[model samples]
Target: MLLKKSPSNPIQAASMGINKTEDQAISGWERLRFLYEQPSMERDLSRRIINMAFLTGFFFGGVATSAQARETFERSNIGQRFLSASDVLKRQADYAIVRFAKSGFPMGFKCALVSGSIVYADFLKIFHCG
Candidate 1:
């Protein structure tokens, strides 16, 4: 004959929903603490931390090296093409401005840098050049 298994403690029964009201009364932090106390949870947390640290270091190192490489490239002749292009554009713009002035039309021009910002701060407007 097999004996029927039974709860060995009152709180065990209360925790098992035999006392649904008591279980519902447990705070969210208390529930999280209970789940976090498991060995499986501890192992998972440690693994996640290690993975995150590795990824962060890899990305940070990549960005630092790329920045240095970009600076070096910008100093080379090929990279100086950007400045030559800008000068050509300015010449064309100046020619257009002279033509527009001779035409005497109500035309206006603003030659702002590509990497500049227009900012409004406390009733003051400022144009920042890159």
Candidate 2:
């Protein structure tokens, strides 16, 4: 024997149009069809492209700045000496001494070295450089 299901609520049954077929229900792709049919689709697409380009440029700009900083640090006098130092000394050394002039005072800077190059430096103290 087969059983026929009946609507539990009269209002819901009327709103749902009991005669409507299952095929009339909206599907996932059909719901998104309105986006493609929109008049401002081209404007939205152009905005998305511009946003992506700006993000890409910002990311690469940061990378380039980091590389430039590393290069500048490596070209300094203290950086040159640090790179030429023996591996054992490089491992033990964590500070660099800097002198601004021939008779100038010396300054010590705490530094982090990586791949035989200075990656970071922070001022530690001013001291005699005799």
Candidate 3:
């Protein structure tokens, strides 16, 4: 008569290569490798990146639109309030005379100040020497 043998554990069976489909608990290193080799994982990462970029672009576009709308509204509202050509000329003449008077001193002072300001301004001007 032959004696009966005891059944081996899953780990011992798999290690002996006699048993297959071992769904038993995997070690830390094996689980990590399995996850690293998994397919469709990169798709999840890429989807998140694309979504973030789209949101950033959308936010900036909204800001730009608001800025443009505000500028348009200001232009429309202020156009009617701007001074007319005749009014502008009268105001400029009035302002120049006031500025000249405020410069103080005499006619000689006026000539010297005017000539100095003009000379420096002309030097700063762009010239097409051609």
TM-score of 3: 0.28
Candidate 1 on 1-130: residue-level lDDT in tens? 9985555543333334354344334443443344345444433554455455545554544444544444444444342444576775575455444543433222111111211122122111232223
The stretch of ten residues in a row with the least summed lDDT in candidate 1 is 107-116
Error of 2 at 28 (Å): 36
* Candidate 2: residue pairs that collide: none
Candidate scoring better on lDDT of 2 and 3:
3
- Candidate 2 segments exceeding 4 Å error: 1-39, 73-130
Compose the digit string of candidate 2's lDDT tens values, residues 27-90.
3333234324444443355445545554555454444455444444456534344454585355
By summed lDDT, the worst window of 10 consecutive residues in model 2 runs over 107-116
- Give the per-residue lDDT digits (tens) of candidate 3, residues 11-100: 333233343343653343433333234444433444455455545554444444554554554555554554677975565455444434
Q: In model 3, how large is the Cα lDDT of residue 91?
A: 53
lDDT of 1 at 47: 49
Could you list the CA RMSD of all candidates, in the order they appear?
22.5, 24.1, 30.6
- Window of ten residues with lowest summed lDDT in model 3: 119-128
